[model samples]
Each structure stands twice: as C-alpha cells, then as structure tokens.
Target: MSKMQPKIISTLKAYSKDQFFKDLTAGLIVAIIALPLSIALAISSGVTPEKGLYTAIIAGFFVSLLGGSRVQIGGPTGAFMVIVYGIVAEFGVAGLTIATIMAGIIMVLMGFLKLGAVIKYIPHPITTGFTSGIALVIFSSQIKDFLGLKIGEVPAAFIEKWAVYLKGIGTFDPMTLAVGGLALGIILLWPKVNRKIPGALIALIVTSALVKILNLDIATIGSKFGEISSALPKLTVPEFDLVYIQMLLPAAFTIAILGSIESLLSAVVSDGMIGGKHRSNMELVGQGVANIMSGLFGGIPATGAIARTVANVKNGGRTPVAGIVHSIALLLILVVFMPLAKMIPLTALAAILIVVAYNMSEWREFKSLLKSPKSDVLVLLITFFLTVLVDLVVAIEVGMVLAAFLFMKRMSEATQVNIEDFDASEEKDGVPVEVHRFDSVDLIKVYEINGPFFFGAADKFISALGELGEKTDILVIRMRHVPIMDATALHGFKRMIEICQRQKTKLIISGIQDQPYKVLEKAGLIDVIGEDHFFTSAVEAVDYANKSVKAHKSGIDSRVL
Candidate 1:
C-alpha cells in the first residue's frame, strides 16, 4: 500500500474563495464554542485557566495544519479532567508536563506503527463506563465553584469530595449560586434568542458584567488565580528526574491511548456528517505533534473535540482552513480581551462545566448497557465502579482483562466435538450409492473437531482426544469445521499424534482448512504424519484407509496398517 498523507495537501488542491469564506465563518463560530470549554476543562484538570487557552491556540492550530480530518478542533477536553486532576494531585504540575510530553512521544510511535485503527478495539462497554464516570467526576469537581463553597483544597476522591462538600453546606454563598444559575439559564436560552452569536460567550459577558456592576461578593478568576497573563506562551522545559519518568509511564500510556481513541472517534463522527473518509494513522500523527507543542508551551494534552468538530461541520466548514481559523480566533481573543477574563465569576465557569458534564454523561447508554448480556453488564459495572472508586488506569486495565476472559469463555462454549459414523448420511438415505466406505467400519473411529483451536479451547480438544479408545484400527480426525489453530493447539495436536503412534493406530487428518493447514505445515506436523495421511475430504480419507487396511489383511503390504 502507498504511504498515507495529510488531508490539507489534498484539500488545497481544489480550494476556492467561496470555500475559504465559509471556512472562516465556521472557524470563528467554533472558536466561540471552544473558548469557555478550554478554560473550564483546565480548571477542572487542576491548572491555571490561561493554560487552557494556550492549548486551544497551539494544539488547535497544528492539528488542523497536519491533521487528516478537515474540521477537527484540538484542545484540552472534559474526558481528561479526572486523569489530569489525579496526576496533578499525586505528582504536581511538573509531573503532568512530563507525562504529557511522554504521552506525545508514545502517540507519535503509535502513529508511525499504524496503530490508530487498532485502538478502536477498546470495547463499547468500557468506554461507556469510563466516560460516564469521568462526567460524574467533572460535575463533582465543579460543585465547589458552582455553590461557591468556602472549602480549602478539595480532595480528588469522589466520596471524600462529597464528604467535604456536605460539611461546607453552611458556607454556600447565595449570590454565587444566583450567578451560576443565571449563566446556565442564559446558555440554554440564548440559542433560541440569536444563533449568530454563541451562547457561552454571551453568558460569560453578561455574568461577568452583572458580578462587576452589582458588586457581588463571589470568587472570581482574578480573586482565586490572580490576573492571568495575556501574552503569548513561552517555551520552557520542565524539571524531571529519571525516577519521575519511570513513575509517570503508566499515566503517560493512559493519556496516549485515551487521546488516540478520542481523536479518531471524533474524526469518524465528523466523517459521517461530511461524507469524507479520514486517514486514521495520519490523524494520530497530527494529534501527537499538537500535544507535543502544547506541552512544550506550558499547556496540557489535547485531542480532536467532537462537539467543536460537529459545530464546524454545521457552520459550513469543510476544510482544514476552518480549524486553523478557529485557533487564530482564540489567539486573537487571548491577546485582546484577556484582561476582562479576570472578572468572569468562577460560578459561571463551574455552571458551564456542569452543563458539559450533563451533556456528556452518556447515562442513557449506561442504562442500555445494563440491559445487555451478563458479560457486558459485568464489564460495564466493574469499569464504572473502578473509575469512580480507584482510578482511570486501574479501571481500564481490569475492564479489558474481564472482557478478554469472558470472550474466551464464550468461544469455548461455541466449540463442539462430535463423533459420527463415516456412512451416517448414506445410511439415513437407505440407498446403494457409490461412496467411500471403510473396511471393518465398526472398528474405524472418526473424531470430528470443530472450532478455532486457541489457548482457551486447546485443553478441551486434548480432553476429547484423551477419550479415544485404544482398540481403534484406523482413526480419522475431521477438521474442516475448525477455522484456525495457534501454537498451543499445535502442541496439543502433536501430543495427540504421539499417542496414536504409540497405539500403532493408523492416523489420517482430513478436511483441514487453509489456516490450520498452514500452521501445521509451518510446525512440520504434516510431515510428521506423512503426506499420504492427509486428504481433502473425510470420504476420501476413509476410502484410502479402507483400501490400506484391506491391503494389509490380504497380505499385499502389511506395512499399510
């Protein structure tokens, strides 16, 4: 196959002025949608709000420049809230920077190795479980800001967060709750009022103005994090030790895998809307580069955002130009209006995130999964509970293991072993038809093995073979129904052959499929059984066996037995 290429080069080949204008409009629109989200997600991830804008500007621009999707918008996402918060809690901001950079390198390797499509194998149940769990965590994180609770350094654990929140009930400020409630109501109603301007921006502007004009006593961004810088991001390497890198490996891997999955899934969803196919591997590489730039410039890890991408598509965006325009729009906002960001009530951002969590919760999917098969339900519950109770890394690891074991159990159940007479079909017809019938048919035993012979079913095959009586003069193992075999099953087959050899029973392996035949040929099992002992059909093998036994009985060649 030819090597993959970025979508921008291909897209520009047919670029037009009309397309540019459409892209520009859509890009500006998505930027409005992304601005508040980037800040909220950063705060949720335990970082300064400006870092979110930095990621939206840097990662957002490069993903479109080098990405395989025409309209994918990259930035810190809600999905990373729990993970990033946990990392910051345990290892601090420097550790998070190191982990993000490491994850970027791993993502690049994954792209180079063409593993983008492979990550799609993560089960639906696991994703649903973890995603819903993340939404809950995000909602929980925003509660302190939403209620303006007077609490110091809230804990990361879910139960503990609630316990602390419960204790701080008396400290809830009425004015802050009103600001949050008004901002949420404005966001919900502004779309119907006017579609040209984004609701979040209007909500943010109105709430900040109300807080400033009314002289309300509430926590603002400046009040908490101090006035954030409006200047461009500076490049600086974070302090890291070898021990830190080793300790951060697991978190980095989790980041890489989740980032890849989220980006490709967004690309796929956008592709369906626009009737365009995205190059998965190329998309991963673009995301990797974006993340690397983000970390280098004091930002967090990022990926393609489904909400922003869809907004781009709906706003007439059909090229990478739109995504680039979106990033430029954010940068312009950061440079021009960042001073005003200081006045934005923390309650408003918290309310915005609460809305985000509610939208992304996937509670309906979670309920539907509970009604699925027991195995699926088991994986879903385990992953969900683990994510809420333990950590994201542990939840994913255990969920995958449980899914694999359940899959093996189902495969074993589907596999079957049957022993049927050679002429069973002919006897049912009760007609004298020309067919391969073995001599001394009663003494000939046919063991038909069915199913893919893999690790789980190897023991089942061996157990069935162990029941083969020693008195059989000729044995034919029919394997046409067996789809494939692995190293373990090949070993089991060799052991079965050894047993037959010791019994001096003539052995013929018939109707072997292509995959199993290739495996046996590579293992030299075919040569060990002799070429003449293999046949295309069970009837042909029976005929050959019948002829050989008759020849040995008639003293033509005693060795034929």
Candidate 2:
C-alpha cells in the first residue's frame, strides 16, 4: 500500500504453486533469450561478455525483487552500446565502473526527489531520433565482425569506422562469413518453426557447434578476448581521483538519463500488456538500486529491456517471480556452461547483434517522421546527425533546445492582440451609432487580446499597448481569452498601465480568465488599478468608462477637484 510494498510483495501475498510453475517456465525462456543479447551488448560496449551475464544475474534479480512494475525484466540493453563504448575509449574499465556507480547514485537521487514524472516531459521526437541513430550506429559497428574483416580497432565515428572496415574488406574470412550468414538465417527462420524455444539460443548453439566440430578457421571469444573468468564477480570498489570523477560526470549523466528513459518505457509497455499501472517514482528508485548493485558486481549499466519484458508477458509471467526466476536461470547457466561460452564464434555473436540492430533501427518510423511537421523533421534530423557524427550527449541537449524553441514559436503564434477602433467596429456591426451617440464618439479605445500572455508574447503586447492614441480618455482591454500569464507579461502589463496613467487615461480590463486574474491579484496589479476598474463583461467596462468620460466632460468627476 505504501513505498514499503514492492509489487513483488503484493504478488507474493497471493502466490500459489501454480503461479510458481508458470513463473519458472517464463523465467527460463527469458534467460535463454537474454544470454546472447547480453553478451553481444557487452562486447559492443568494449567489455567482456561475462560482465553482461553478471548484469543479467545481479541487476535482473534486484530489479524484479524491488521494482514497481509486475513484468519488467532489467538487464543490459542495446541503448547503452554507444555511450559505454565512448566512455571505455576515453577512460578504461575502471573509469567506466566509477561512471556507472556515480550514474547509479544520480538515478537514486532523482527517484527520491520524485523526478521520475519530470522525465516524462522529455519530448518523444528527441527519444525517437536518438533511438534510430543508435540503431544505425549499432548496425554499422557489427559490419566488421559480421564479415570477419581483420580490421584494427575501428574509429568511433560512423564514417571513419566504415572507412576502416572497408579498407579491411579484402581480409574477410570465407568460413567466418558463412557462419555469420548461417546463424542469421537460422535466427530469421527459427521463430516460425517453434515459439517456445528462442531462435537466438538455437542459433548460438548450432553455430558454435558447427565452428567447433568443423575446425573452422575463425576468431572466437577465446581467441580474441582470451578465457573469460568463470568465477563469480567479487566485491571490489574502484578507486577514483577527483579529477577523473569530474571528467566522468558527463558520461555518468548520459547513462543515468538513458537508463531511466529505457527502463520506464519498458515498464509502461508491460503495464499495457498486463492491464496494470506502474508506480513511476518507485520504478525509478528500483532501477537506481539495480544499477548500483550491478556496478558493485563489476557489471555495466542495466535497465528494463522491452523485448524481455514482452516475452515474459507473453509467456504467462504475471508477477515478479518470473523476473527473479529469469535471473536465477542466467546465474545457473553462467556457472555450469561457462566453459562452452568461450567456443562461441565472434561472427556468430556478430550475426545475432546484426539482427538485433536491424530490429532496433526503427527505420520505418524514422522515414515516416521525416514527412511529419517541419519542426519535428528538424528535431529528428539534428538529433540523428549529431548522434552519428558527434556524440549522444550533444545530440540530446541540442535536440531538446531546438524543440523548445519551436514550441515557443508556436505558442507565440497562437497569442495575438488587435487594437480595434471602438467607433468603427461598432458601426460596421450596425450596432454603434446609437450607442456612440449616448456614450461618446471616438473617446474610448478597445484592445482585444487572445491566448497565453507568456514571455514570448510579452514584447509584442507591450509595444501594441504603447501605440494607444493620445486622444484616448479611457482604454478598455478585452482579456477574456488570455488563459495564462507569466512574470514577464505581467511586467509588460504593468508598464502599459503606467503609460495610460501618465497620459491621464483610465484603464479598464474586462473578462480576464481565472488564472490571469489571480496572477494580477497576486502581483498587486488588481489593487493598484482598483478592483472597481475590472468588469465581468466588455459592455460593462465600456459603459462604466463612458459614464466616467461624460462626468469628466461636465466637470463633475470629483467635488474636491
């Protein structure tokens, strides 16, 4: 009922043996699915494949045990590949460890500060733009291993990486190419044959065995990276100097933001599938806790994986037990099958990742978004190019800023003010000759304003106010449509009032909406202008001003005067 109650607690309160059996089956399925993907992500991120397994085992367990969503399965996902690789390129594995731990701390602070809801305000165009860009980068990265090209470490830039890879095309191993293609074919075709067993696991096993028994001349995990430590991850805190910590802050922030977005997106998808709602703040806290634990255990940044979460939902996983079981299954596999993992061919992992990248690319959505509104298209392109040519950190920042500016432009366009000649407008509508005869002709000025009076529209509205005629004895402003106002606009309004007062003109504001009315009240503008000056209707304000003007003409405004 409270923060103390994780979703797991509620689910387990109604737990049964039947649910356990279903959870166990679902967990095993997800673990098999997670194994190859985790290893691939780790290698792409410039870490040993075993660290991916550790993340799946450690982070996966804690996320399910403490997370706010029922079906979210947390682990190493494709989103981190670019950022993790860049961090590793600049600062070694120790530096990465420090960044991950600091990122974990930042996430925890965000959760505690109730910043999860705030993260939702991050625009969708920016997310989609970066996602597609990452997908392209990932796909390009796999080109070297997929073709078994003997290229030295490829440059991080997209074009540069391709140039390096293209130069080494002559060194492609025929046997490795065959293995990668065969693995890809098996994965693409396996799902139609059977849904219970995963295509990835089958591809990994068959490809690894083929390479081993055939004595194929190809690079493998063992040959390239050497033997992976089969032992459990031990507790070791990475020492960091202040200089390095400061250097890693940008990288850490990137990880935290990306992890939070990915995890919450997965959680939201799971919620839709299960007809349930997730506690967003609690989920953030849970993910933060999971990342902290994962880093401590020598693992990379981990978050809820949408693919795994969906698989869990489809396989009768109704509660957190499925995620827990998935973690346990991975742990058992790591311990028992640690030796066999080394025999896995690099090309085979590359094949699996190529497929992963293709699916993650979301090219269809990218193309469609290009045909969208001009602002959206601009944001998409800026984010896309920046992600490929520069870095993810810059892409997100610039995209957000660009989107904000476009949004302000639209808001300003919607807000408008028009100064109408009271006599002319009344005459055109055939209502005013009689009214003007009774009230006073060309003596009162009316300004009509519509939409929000935020900062963007402040200057224009202020300029228009200063253009009021010197002959104006009374100024009536129609604000029935102004839904909101900020300090800048309020200041503009006060200045306008001051000018009217200096010219010895009375200002009457009519039909202001509730919010702006309250704002003016709070700013003491209402009292300064006199509460009697505000009228509930335009007609009333105009009538009151007419009476005052008439009184002034007769030298009867005040006896003291």
Candidate 3:
C-alpha cells in the first residue's frame, strides 16, 4: 500500500504462467516497434544510432523492473527529442550526460519530497503549445536527411535552419527523397494490411533492402555516423567543472520537468487502459533511476513512451514483466542485428521521424485550443511561437508566469464585496412585513464579502471599505461566503481596523467561517478588534450595534444635562 512500492512487486504476488506468456509476447512486439524508433530518435537527437538503443535497453529495463505502473513501457521518446538535441548541440554528448544525470537526481528528490502530484498541474495549453512547437522543430531538423541536401552542419536556430535548408534545396539527391517517400508510404499504409507488425520496422527493412540492392548513392547510417555498436560502451563518469554545472543547471531542470511530465502522463494513460492505479511518486523514482543509468551507459535521455505502453496494454500485457521483456528483446536485437543497421538509409529514418513529428504535433488539439478563452489562447500562441522561434526553456518560463498573472486576474473578478442595506419589506401571509428595518440603519454599514479573501482580492476589499461615509457609527463585515483568507487579506482587515479606530467608529465582524476566523485569530486581528464585537449572524451583530449606539447617545444626553 506504500506509494513508494513498485507495481511489479505487487503484481508478481498474483502472477501466473499464463500471464507471463502474455507478457512475453507483448514485450517482443513492443521491442519490434521500438527498434527503428529508437534509432531514428537518436539520430534526430544529434547522437549516434547506438546511443538510442543504449537508452532503450538500459532505461527501459530499469523502468520496467522498478516502475509504479504495471504496463508503462519506458525508453527514448519523441517528446524529449527537441530538448535533448539542444543540450547535445550546446554542450556536446559529455555535457548531455552530466545534465541527464543531474536531471535524474532532481527527479529522485521530487519523488521523495512527494512532488509527483504537483507536476501534473502543468497547464494543458503550455503542454500542447510546446509539444506542437517541438514537433515543428523536429520536422525542420530532419529536412536535410529527408531530402539528402548537400549541406554542412545545420544551424540550431529555427529560422536559420530553414534558411540553410532553402539554400541547399538545389542540391537534394532524388534517390534519397524516393527512399524517404517509400518509407513514409509504408509507415502510413502498413497498418491497414497488418496491424500486428510495426510499420517502422517494415519500412526500415524494405527501404534498407531496396537501397542496398539498387546500390543507391544515398547516405546511410554507416555513411554518416559509421557502423552501429553491437556492444555496450564502458560506463564513464562525465567530466564536469562548477562552470559547466552552473551553466547546465537550467537545462538539467528542463529535462527533469519534461521527463517527469511525459513519464507520468504515460503511466496515467496505461493505468486507464488496464483499470489499474499507479504509484506516481514511485514512477518518478523509477524514471529517475532509469535516466541515471541511461546517462552512465552512454545513452540519450529517456522516459515512458505512451505509444509503446498503449501497444503493450492492447497486446495483453498486464504487468511490468512485459516492459522488462521489451528491454531484453531490444538488447538481443542490438547485439545480433546491429551490423545490419549500418546499411539502413538515413532518409528512411528521417521519414520515420517525420511521422513522429506529425504524431507529436497534436495539430487538432492546437486548433481546438485556439478557440478557447482569449487568455488561454494568448498563452497557447505565445508558448507555441516562443518554442519555435526561441528556446523551449524561455517559452515554458514565460508561459507559466503569464498564466499565473491571468489566473489571478480571473480570481479577483470572481471575488465580490457588496454593500448591503437591510431595508427591504416582504409580504407575510398576505400582509406587509418589514425585515430588520431600524432607526439607526443609516448609521450601521454592512459589507458582505464573497469568495476567498486572498492577495488577488485584497485591493478590492480595501476599495469597497473606502465607500463608507464619514458619519458612519459602525462597520460590520459579513464573511459567511468567505471560505478562506490569506495574509494579504488579513493586512487589509488590519488597515480597516485602523481607519475605524481613527474615526471613533465601532467595528463588528459577523458570519466568519472557520478558515478566515483562524486566519484573523492567528494574525491577532480578533484581539485588536475586540472578540466581544464578533458575531455569528449579521442580524445579531446589527442588533448589538443598534443598542450600543443608543447607549452612547444616552450617555451624551446625560452629560449635556
């Protein structure tokens, strides 16, 4: 029952041979699906193809062994492609290793600190915006390979990258484009023919065979990054100084936040499919360990892949065993089939990544979000544009701040302060009746506050009280509808008390809720305003104020006599 317990440990208690067989089948299928994707994502991320397999093998194995979700299949995913590529470009692979390890540490800390639930609150618009932006960026990054453009290193900036692509448009190799087209066509159309087999795998095999048989002069994995390594590279500690750590800290935080979001989202999706609950904190811990191991093993950053996890669930995978099998199966493919990867055309991988970009784009969601409220639309568009035109870090940072301010504005509008006059007449049993009409009604002012009294609404509270006339004998604040209060609202109340004291006016509070009462009591405002002046009902407080005013007037008359 502990939140830190891995789902594998719980599921294994009731495990059966039948379920193990099912898990095995599903795992092998997922591994097939992951193969071309892992290679393509790695190449797209500015790393060698073998590194992607390293991530899938190392990170995937650990995630399955220790994850909180029964069917979460973890590995290198397209969502991380943009950020990972940026880190690799800026700091090189060594820098990326350090950042990834640092990110893993942060994730572990987040899990232990019970911050898993908080990460889910990231605004949907921001997620969608950046995702769509990243998709476009990924698409842009692959243009060189997709077209076989004779270009040197592509620029990192979005605009500059496109400019370079345009300049080299004349140098595109027709054979390479044909290979990419064939791969893209197979990927898009293969599901209709055979749903069980992964389209990317078929495309990889068909395109590679065709290119080799024809002896096309297209750039292949071997031509660009050399042969894929069949063996895992020795684990090495990333060398770093304080300057690199400080410079990479923000990048590391980005990776942690992004990885946590993607992995938890995957776990949640898998949980729904299987009608199971996942330990979110434990999932974070698992992902943390996986990423740390991935970095040590010369792998790119990794997280739970939603598509693969969904495939696992649909293929009868009911436990983490399937995920574990997926990793093992991929490793076997790496050690046995890695040499064949050398002949796979780069254009085919580019086509696969293009599909990835399309899936990641979420264009329909982006369009729907455009029709949302203007504030939401603003946040979405700004985040999207900033993500494409600038850095993802800047986009997320600005979007969060903008969303927070807009949220405060909406909350301020929702909170209301109404000046109430108890002068209305009502009919009782066909007879006219007066409700709380008193002689000193004009002297007693009542302001009823509605909604939470927080910093957002504090100014409104003060301004509402400013409407009081100089001749007011008493001020009563009705807080029945106020569910909570914050320090800012308490400060406003203190200032109100000061004004009442200056005007020699009696202050009374009525219908205060428990939360606001505690807030006032903690701030010593209750004592400052006199506890005797507080009432449970507005009518009772008004009656007490009337009597007090009458007694004060009588005292004035006697002194004059």
Cα lDDT, model 1, residue 170: 93
lDDT of each residue in 499-559, candidate 3, tens digit only: 8988877888988889999988988888888888888766677678777778777775311
lDDT of 2: 0.86
What TM-scores do the predictions have? 0.96, 0.94, 0.95
Clashes of 2: 0
Score candidate 1 by TM-score against the native. Answer: 0.96
Pairs of residues clashing in candidate 3: none
Which ten residues in a row are the worst by lDDT in model 2? 425-434
Off by over 4 Å in 1: 1-3, 423-441, 555-561
Superposition-based RMSD of candidate 1 using all C-alpha atoms, in angstroms? 2.7
Cα deviation at 340, candidate 2, in Å, is 1.2
Score each candidate by Cα lDDT.
0.87, 0.86, 0.89
* Candidate 2 segments exceeding 4 Å error: 1-5, 421-438, 558-561
lDDT of 2 by residue, 1-561 (tens): 215346888788889999899899999999999999988899989999899999999999988988888999999999999999998889988888898888888988887787878888888788988998898899898888888887777889998988888788898888889999999999999999998788888988998899889988888888978887778887778897899999999889989999999998998898899899787777878888888888889999999999999999999998999999999999988888977888898888888888888887788888888888899999999998899889999999899899999999989989998887554322324454322322664777788888899998888898897778788888888887899999999999889888887888788898788999999999999988888888876666666877887788988872222
Candidate 2: which pairs clash? none
State each candidate's clash count: 0, 0, 0
